[model samples]
Target: MQKFLSNKKLIFELFQFNQNFNFARNIYLNVFNKYQKESSIMKEQIKNFYLLLIILSLIALFLISCDNKNKTGTEGRTLSYYAGNWWGKASGETAEENILTINGDSSITLKIGDEIIIPSTSVTRVSDTNYIASYYNSTVNVSTKFTFNFSSDTQGKLIMEITQGSTSQSSTIDITKK
Candidate 1:
């Protein structure tokens, strides 16, 4: 009976919630319930914020990877113009190094060496800026399709490949300008 006395300060402070109280205990239960619901909603939104950030980050990485296909040149650098030393390595049935030297005369020198034997070294330009150097006595041929790969840059990897329907040999070479 004495505990049922009104709390004047509580009633005044919660004047707006006066009509929204639990009549049995005279508590502003409606206001508390609404506040708790809003807080939980805010927490859920914060959790989704991180999830959205993760999805956006993954999309950005995928775009960057697809944008760059061949990645053997310096950043923001196109292929070199002419005349430089290029090296490359390749792997298929066997692995080997391609040492190439290009001259201003539109000629090229390529050496495929594996220590024990130097199969062959040849230099011949088929057309303008296009050259074909063969080794292994025509057994393995590295067709270098060169045009806009380099201009005057100093560092790069030479792309060399054995001709299709030619043989069962491949090599990839890493090169630097001399």
Candidate 2:
């Protein structure tokens, strides 16, 4: 009877140990599965962030290249832009439809109504779009100075101020490229 009782107690202890081992294994498996799921989500987030960064970098590079190309288009400027025939109305007492010709060699001819005047002139560049044209007319024997303010390569405003024998006249002309 003592041997049987001792065997029964040993069997009960073994059964309890088995139950505890199974419970611990279940807890470990649950914790491990949760950790693995969280780690996978973190990896996906990091990958998405890197992809967005690469896309933004490419867009910035593209915009900078386009800006550089536009800057290169308007690089050099010369006096040749003023070498053309322009038709516009001049201001002041002689305000009428005028045909003006600016030659490549810096000569100027003006046709106001039926009268034509050829003025002796010299042009000096002030900046990329500004110039001073000094004119000496021997027929009227007067000196006139013109400020040529160009707004663009194809259009500009001209202001002409002349003094002749105690009389002063000024004219403003808006001209476009022919």
Candidate 3:
């Protein structure tokens, strides 16, 4: 066994193994350093992507909140053109007892005397120049129709021609903004 172990090849391979080991070690360390740098760069890129997403999300949220606020304000209002107290006299009876109130809920209650002439009812938008209101009246047992043709607005006064079908009374009601 001793004679076999004393081979000349083995004696020469010891120096070869040491050189190969040192060369392999240096190459492996260089590769590891480059890999570490690439991994760090990839990590930074991922962080940047996350940050961009967060910013975009915040911007979207802000716009959505602003839209919601505008909508809520509009929804809370009854009408943009008709809001406030109006007083007008129907045909030949200039007693100054006609009063109409348009509420914020798009409802109108009209009073012509001590009793309520028109109950609170729904009001719908027709167009920029017209608005029609028709209501069921149980007092006289007939459907009463009211039609209005808007002329224009100056300052806060809204001039509209109101026509009541029950008595065929036509009058002008000047609405004021509150």
Candidate 4:
């Protein structure tokens, strides 16, 4: 009877230890599972953030390309560059006052003192900085060519050469944009 009771006591102690161990193990497993779920959520959030950044970057790039495509002609220059009223004086043998009006349609109306230059004047742009204006005089039946050299977008010099039966004369005008 004494040996049997000692054996029963040992069995009871072993069972108590096993129950404590099982309770601790259950707690550890629950904590681990909760931490794993939190980690997975954090990973998903980071991935979503990166994906949104990439999409925004691509949209910005597309907008920039569209803006560039809408721009026109050599720094987006238009006919307005040459459209204005310029006033100056004619230099050389025939010194006189000159007022030149340039239109948007490449037409130029030049006034030298009280007289307007004859034969409807028109301008032709040869390059970015060079232009030629032709003036036809109906009475004289001769065409005078004026060459313009632009020093800047706002100021330039104009030279006109008139030839009539070997009698040729030239004049220069300093022009400024108004």
Q: What is the TM-score of each candidate against the true structure?
A: 0.33, 0.47, 0.50, 0.50
Top TM-score prediction, candidate number: 4
- lDDT of each residue in 1-178, candidate 2, tens digit only: 8899998998888988899988999999899988899899989999999999999999999988877653543344445457787666665545435467776765566665444444334667687688777767679788888777888767888888888988889888887776
- What is the Cα-based TM-score of model 2? 0.47
Please give the lDDT score at residue 108 for candidate 3.
Answer: 63
> How does candidate 1 score on lDDT?
0.51
Better of 2 and 3 by TM-score: 3
lDDT string for model 4 (51-112, tens) is 99999999999999887763445453433467777778665435434478766665666776
lDDT of 1 at 100: 61
Q: What ranking of all candidate models by lDDT puts the best one first?
A: 4, 2, 3, 1
lDDT, residue 23, model 2: 95
Could you say which candidate leads in lDDT? Answer: 4
Candidate 2 lDDT score at position 125:
68
Off by over 4 Å in 3: 1-14, 23-27, 30-34, 40-44, 47-55, 58-69, 79-85, 89-98, 102-107, 125-131, 136-143, 147-169, 176-178
lDDT of each: 0.51, 0.74, 0.58, 0.75
Worst 10 residues of 4 by lDDT: 113-122
Rank the candidate models, highest TM-score first: 4, 3, 2, 1
lDDT tens digits, residues 31-138, model 1? 787889989999999889999999999999999988977666433331224466655554442543446665555345555444222221343433333334443334
Candidate 3 C-alpha lDDT tens digits along 1-178: 7766777568768778988998999999999998999999999999999999999999999998887754434343334356566555544665544367655555666665443434335455566545566666566555545655545432222233333354454344444322
